[model samples]
Target: MSETPITISNLNDYIFCPASIYFHSLDYYTDTLTYQDSYQINGTAAHNAVDSSTYSDNKNILQSISVYSERYNLFGKIDLFDTDNHILTERKKKVNKIYEGYIFQVYAQYFGLTEMGYRVHKIRIYSMDDNKMYPIALPGENPDMLKKFEVLIKNMNKFELETFTQENIKKCSHCIYESLCSFSRLKE
Candidate 1:
């Protein structure tokens, strides 16, 4: 793998559509094309407290902290880390179902923190919309999923736009970069 680390959040985006990452790298800006849907708007709004690093004043509850795993070559900001209880959480605006992407995100954070000498006994996802917490099993408990996550990291390290294709038409139709992606199958 190259020295450059992969952003942990991009793992979720990669799961959504690899082409979106290519467009994101372009840094496009247009008033009409860059529209924010309700989901996007709500997600941003939900992250405000963590983004501002004011979610909590307690030292045990860390929010919006950067974490990195040199072993996995991954780096990203974690939403919350409870030192007192050794819980790592990734909060979402809402969740209809617990997707693999969500699991991978928190798993990445868990690995990053543990690699950095932190004891993350539990991993979780918090839905701001319903105000519920869902716990995830540790990677060791799920060897198959951990192997898949390892493969994902390896693939991301050598990602190529030409070879990457988003095969899910349903996902393409709802993607924010649908209009911008050349591989997008969404038809107006």
Candidate 2:
């Protein structure tokens, strides 16, 4: 089988559970109940609105911009790309803490933009819930995180799992593929 493309979203699943990559690569998805959350629903709508909005070229905010990095073999859509200031703002519905995966994703975008010849000056995470912007400290090159992505990609392609445990029951509970994910350690 062909290898699956490593995406920015995979970082989230990898942080949650490496085995999830395997399931996702196989296309063995199940409609678990997590989508019913109102928060997620609202977040989707908000993202859609931002993505589809026909905002004039205000020379400040650009929404739903595509970014890619050939060096890291990853790509993703940035939520808000500030053109005038060269600041990439990623929007989240809510975040209690800035997780490693989030940092990696943002930094990857920064690297990608740099590789693409855009002078990305800063990166920030804008919490929609708090209506606040939290600046992210950019680390120029994250070989460790890139290596982790490589390992996960290799594991997924070879059907090799380093572990089969859920990161946490709470995370597994919120997973839409919980029903189909065999490695899900969520107890019945």
Candidate 3:
């Protein structure tokens, strides 16, 4: 809320739904997510994997796991923070088995936290498939990656949408917001 141009949460808002992004920008971060949420599951898996494999605290590489950058107001959990190496690792989860793109989450973390003066070395994509994990590493603060992420969030923020438009899209498809969206009233 401190006027950072980017944040991990905002990136997620854009990913889920543009309307969600706008609502959050207006300071509406509620408990709309649950344990069964796929996004949570994927992110947790990625975090856990990195927590176990990389960045030993005893070595003085990582100060904390989920670091909150006061400068950019970016809240994100880093996979590995190599303070000694001056590097950071962010985990990205793909919706499909094949790794596509998760730059928004990765770079938003970098761009935001970098504003706070942390040298980010890499953003790793931890792709999941057949109950297995694949590690893909990308350079931190890549202009191409940052630009792509920025464009995405810009689109999400610029759009004006009716709060209830989701109802017409997939209200009957096991949506959590069906009732809140008033889809039930339409059928009645």
**Candidate 1, residues 23-125: lDDT per residue as tens digits?**
6555335445566444323345556788987788999998888899988999988889999999998888887778888889889999889998999999988
lDDT by residue for model 2 over 1-188, one digit each (tens)? 33344676566556656766566555424534344433223234446656776534565787766777776666776667777789887777776777666676677677667887878888887777878778876564556765765565455445447545565777678766677766666855
Best by TM-score: 1
Total colliding residue pairs, candidate 2: 0
Q: Would you give me the overall lDDT of model 3?
A: 0.50
Per residue, candidate 3 scores C-alpha lDDT tens digits across 81-149 of: 556665555544545542223555655555545666776665444454444444334433356755665
Reference-based lDDT, residue 34, model 1: 61
- Sort the predicted structures by lDDT, highest score first: 1, 2, 3
Total clashes, candidate 1? 0
Could you tell me how far off, in angstroms, the CA of residue 187 lies in candidate 3 after the best superposition?
A: 7.3
Give the candidate order by descending TM-score. Answer: 1, 2, 3
For each predicted model, how many residue pairs clash, with residues at least 3 apart or on different chains? 0, 0, 1
> lDDT of candidate 2 vs native?
0.64
- What's the TM for model 3? 0.56
